[model samples]
Target: MAAQFDKIAIWLVAFIPMPVAQGLGDCFHGDDRDFSSAPDEQRFRVRSDIVVSGFLAGDPQETDFHQCGETVKLDCATGEVLARETAGTDGMSFHHFNVGNTFPDPEGGVVDNPNEFCVNFLYDGAATNPLGPPGSPDVDMNVFFTIDPIGRMLSFRGATNAFPDYEAYASVEDGPPVVLFQQKHTLDPINGLPGGADQGVSATVAI
Candidate 1:
């Protein structure tokens, strides 16, 4: 999937509550769901640090079915994810992605901020969705993570160009938390027709 796109920019964003997929069962049920009591157990409830907003990526979006949504495996002691040649990626190193180049480096054309991290998904690109037709234009999305000096907040939004016929969903992590990310667009632009329309929402929540 990464091979098709020259680059993918990713970032952290907010979420809203959603319904569970049919037959998902109790696999995602957290033990200490009550907020007034155990809070640590709820940390796992985030399900994913990375939320995909496009058609979709790979299959098995769930975390081994043990947890809902997808998670980037962390090296627990160091809190770093490995850059390697993984399956379904066709062997591209995460370290080699063309990322963060578009970010503004100088303040008043002078200095660097040095605090921003990689929003790892594509800010502008049409990705290949697994469910899309063979060699087809699958997903179009954009994510800007505090690039502007005035606003240092995460922003994830997109106008997906695809032919799914059904509405385009902000391809979120598989088996997400109680909430899900979604966006709606008209059938014209994506389907090569007329009368374009797009709809989306964002929220800032305190944990």
Candidate 2:
């Protein structure tokens, strides 16, 4: 069955508590700050560290998958590619991508205040028992990060599976977390659709 984006958003909002939801908002827009005003030279001096982590969730067989793409960091304002890391092997279910220090400015300076960035997690693999034939679809997971005025970190991950499942999470941290999980699914790229039964459960809880 095909998965609907609207339905997934509504379900995630319902699953998350009001406080957590508000916290996510704060991360994205709470603080009034921008990187445009900083001088070209000074901007390069400001830096924010980033770390990406995630693991497979649910039944081992159902969640069995691998990443065929890379994790990338993009400048929110210009949509420029800042850095990227390659995907891990199939045997390594838990994945982590760390860009220790990122300079958000064009001059390669650090961004000391509130700023926004995006991380993409892409995967192409098969499940042990997918709703359809294995290796047919690709999964694209995204995480958006906002650094508050004081450098507090807030992030959110939301992805729709080629299978009948979705995963999402919101988190706040003083520094980058040691690990994060990549949402999983089975898809058929040729047909451009998911190929599995609807597993009616919110995998966000695992986050």
Using all chains and alpha carbons, the TM-scores for the candidates as numbered come to 0.28, 0.25
| RMSD value for candidate 2 | 22.3
lDDT of 2 by residue, 1-207 (tens): 111111010001101111110111121111112222221111110111222322112111111223222334444455555555443333223222222234253234653432222122222222221121345333222233322212323333333434322332233222212223322324323322344323222222211
Off by over 4 Å in 1: 1-102, 105-126, 129-133, 147-152, 155-159, 162-182, 188-207
Q: Which window of 10 residues has the lowest lDDT sum in candidate 1?
A: 21-30
Query: Which stretches in model 2 have alpha-carbon errors above 4 Å?
Result: 1-134, 138-140, 144-163, 171-207
Instruction: Please give the range of 10 consecutive residues that has the lowest summed lDDT in model 2.
Output: 5-14
Report, for every candidate in turn, its global Cα lDDT versus the true structure: 0.25, 0.25
